[model samples]
Target: MRRSRFAASVTSLLLATGLALTGAATAQASSTAATGGYVALGDSYSSGVGSGSYISSSGSCDRSTKAFPYLWNAAHSPSSFAFNACSGATTDDVLAGQLGSLNSSTALVSISIGGNDAGFADIMTTCVLSSDSSCVSKINNAKAYVDSTLPGKLDTVYNAISAKAPSARVVVLGYPRFYLLGQSCLGLSDTKRSAINSAADYIDAAIQKRALDHDFVFGDVRSPFSSHEICSGDSWLHSVNWLDIGESYHPTAAGQSGGYLPVFTANAS
Candidate 1:
């Protein structure tokens, strides 16, 4: 009986130690995964367009302290951080400009691109100012570009990223749907709003496909921004502001924190 008791005690102690060790290992690994150099790349969405409080040093690129990349770096204290994303950046722009600052030391990267490539500004301008038929035509043109040419452009950028940051975990983020469908929005009619949302979905789908093809994580923000889209009572996005035309149709700071940041945090590994 004495021997059996001693054996049982030893077994329990071993199990406890093993569980503790496993937990420690998990914590350490998570820390390690999030600790290396973080490089932010791509366009205005990543650079914080409507979020405001832009980094003065960033000039026209409009990097914001409120941006998800800046917020994540602030929270995690990565060994190094390079905010290379710019406003008005297309796939070609990223390919030419943003590929710097990525290296083997980079443990994580996040990007939001392909919107400008698909003529985001043009579509918005047409939708807001032109007839509903014109808006639909513009959206259809954008969709065609997304379906045809954007894939190759995205592939080029993704390939360059892989080459530049050979070991980094890449997270490719998608834009939020512009409007809450079935809700009463002021500017655009439901037809226009629905078409715009459909365009957003198309862009996101294209981005996701290429991200997956490159073995990168696709961070979809639509789900997070669902009830909080522009037409929602609690909207996270900015509708057209004639005062600051540049800030039109972009995520507000809340969208960055409550939407994009959380999605990135969940998928940063």
Candidate 2:
């Protein structure tokens, strides 16, 4: 009887141990499954236009492994990653082409947009080619558009993103001031540079308002890029890469790694 009782006790202990191990395994599997899915959607900035080393498969989207999205995904190991950002994409482009990648299963979404919608390229060209007064006038025109027409357009895009990825944490990344306030380079005078920076601020403010309205996160990159503006000696943004005109005025690899990535990761919850 004593031997039988001892055997039964040992059997019970073994069974409890087995259950504990199984529970541990189940917990681990659950943790892995809960890591979340990330999707990046936006325009040239998000696609890493100036960072170079584009992913061939991404084509005109010009996605680079060095882009913040890829870097973030590599570090976090999201369950899935979809890079849908394209070069020269406007708000309409995002609605038409990029929104398809987002769905209820998407856990995180990051975007840098609205610059093109404000005709940033045209403004830059005008500034480069025209007088300071003309540039200031053009910048004022863009700001007026941002204050008037842009709010409605941004609302539409933000609303659609919210609808498509209802459960995901959406982060709206803003553009950096391309030039330092008082410094001038690349034929841009201090006045023109200040105007351009002001335009960027206007764009960021509009984006921030939209993000707040939709209860989404706004990743402000101005602080990170403060010391790295184009006129700075240690700038992280490209200053008129004539050989790669498409890459001109965009963030460098250092900008993507040190500027965008940190702001994105910190606000990516």
Candidate 3:
């Protein structure tokens, strides 16, 4: 009986030490994965529309391989990535479009939306280039919708993300300047690019406010590209030789790394 009791005590002590060591190792690995890793959300800006990039050939969101998240991941080597950003997605798209890809393991998320919600693309083509006030009215309508409806949609996204990633940090991305404030583009006169940018700013601010409310990180790409506006020399967007053609507005590879990647990293931490 004495021998059996001593053997049992020894076994129990060994088991306890093993469990403690396993737990510590797991914690250390999790901390390492959490440092530079993240999941990406949102629309074209996050997906890299006109940026000529592709993440995978998967028939889902067509996330770009050259998008900011990928760039950030490559630079820092994150443990995992779930990018579900789609071009032309609205705020509702997050729930109906991009939630399944996220999970508890995700360490971060980024998104840019609300442009398609207001038919913003159409407005740019019609109003900014035409003499009608329809574009302005439509823009106003879009802003109102964003201010009112965007929050609820974002709330749903936030809740769903939390359900999946209880420990993940969320980053909401914003649009870049798509048009010149005072400069005219191909066959366009009296452009409302400033107004469009302002509307985008408003949406970005709203997204940021939502982030603060949820204690998530709000990553705005507006100010960073302010000096690199469309039509400006050394523009962050627009390809070489097409000073008038390169989509007039999207982040160059350099811009993505410099302007957006830092925001993602800071918030990811």
Which number leads on lDDT? 1
Q: Put down candidate 3 lDDT per residue, 7-103, tens digits, no spaces.
A: 3343443355552011221222224344644677777667764455565674435465667776666555667776777765766777786877677
Cα-based RMSD of candidate 1: 19.2
Sort all candidates by TM-score, best to worst. 1, 2, 3
- Select the stronger candidate by lDDT from 1 and 3: 1
Model 3 lDDT-worst window of ten: 19-28
Top-scoring candidate (TM-score): 1
lDDT of 1 by residue, 56-126 (tens): 99987889999888888877778998999998888888888888899988999999999888888777766
Q: Candidate 2: which pairs clash? A: none
Against the true structure, candidate 2 reaches a TM-score of: 0.86
Give candidate 2 misplaced runs (Cα > 4 Å). 1-34, 184-186
lDDT of 1: 0.81
The lDDT of each candidate is 0.81, 0.79, 0.61
Error of 1 at 248 (Å): 1.0
TM-score of each: 0.87, 0.86, 0.76
